[model samples]
Target: MSEQHTYRVIVRGVWDGLSEDSRARLLAEVDDHGLTAMTFSEEGSLTYDRALKHFSWRFTVVSDAADGDEMAAAIAEDRAASALAALGHGFRDLRSTVTDLDTMKINYKGGRR
Candidate 1:
């Protein structure tokens, strides 16, 4: 059986060509999308600052592909785009970075390696 890996993907992009109404709506909902609400979730968590110049989406994905990291990143980026579109938001320079949790080494609190 192929092994599955859990990945945390962060998709980042800049807001582009947002209408005044959309901008106002986002600003009004800032409390819900603020840094305090950020999380790595399968459904994705979107976060941005009050400035609204840039934003990021955090997604938790599980994949069994040999290139799970890349695949997870791609999936997260696409999901982010769809979400932005659904909200009538425009984004540019979308990019994603993924971390494979299975291969990640935890640093011990003690001196143990």
Candidate 2:
């Protein structure tokens, strides 16, 4: 069996050509999409504000070690776009970045070794 790695994908984009009704509805429910609700999960979570100028979606994706980070990022970007479309939201300038937890290195400060 092959090993699997967990990747944290962050997809960012800007709202594009939102209708008046869509903007109003988003503003009304803005509180629910605030920074406080931001988290990384398989299903993804979105963070935005009243301005709605920009938004970010956080996704925790798992990939086979051989598939690597690029594939995971692509998957995340697709998932984010799909989720947004499902909610009837329009966005542009979509971009995604990914971090592979399995290969990440952390430096410990002055603490118990």
Candidate 3:
């Protein structure tokens, strides 16, 4: 049987100067990317120390049998990139993590050691 996998996209640094329209644009971008589920926190709630603060927007992308094996990974990646691009300012950086079904651990730049 084919193996299962999970993909996640974490977006940070949504500039405080962003306008209401821009925020909406970002949400649309996430949806356009084809993520399984997406959610954003209210603005002004996130702090520098805790970037994932109450205000920060967190989007979690899941790739499983429901997404169909042929196109889950590609869709997730595309969505992540698009969402990052939408944050014109206060957009610090975008981090992506992937994991296998058998091993729920992530393999990042650290070499998965």
Q: Which stretches of candidate 1 lie over 4 Å from their true place?
A: 111-113
Q: What lDDT would candidate 2 get against the real structure?
A: 0.91
List, residue by residue over 1-113, the lDDT tens digit for candidate 3.
45445443343333455566766654555434333334332111122222222123343444565554334434544554454455553353433333334445565675555
Candidate 3, superposed: residue stretches over 4 Å from native: 16-77, 81-92, 97-101, 105-113
- lDDT string, candidate 1, 1-113, tens digits: 78889999999999999999889999999999997888999999999977989999999998885867878888889899998999999889999989999999998687756
If scored against the real structure, what TM-score would every candidate get? 0.91, 0.91, 0.30
Q: Tell how far residue 59 is off in model 3, in angstroms.
A: 4.5
Q: Residue by residue across 1-113, what tens digits does model 2's lDDT show?
A: 78999999999999998888789988998999898888999999888998889999999999898999889989999998898888788899989889999999998788776
Instruction: Please identify which of the two predictions, 1 or 3, would achieve the higher lDDT against the true structure.
Output: 1
Model 3, residue 91: displacement in angstroms? 3.1
- CA deviation > 4 Å runs, candidate 2: none
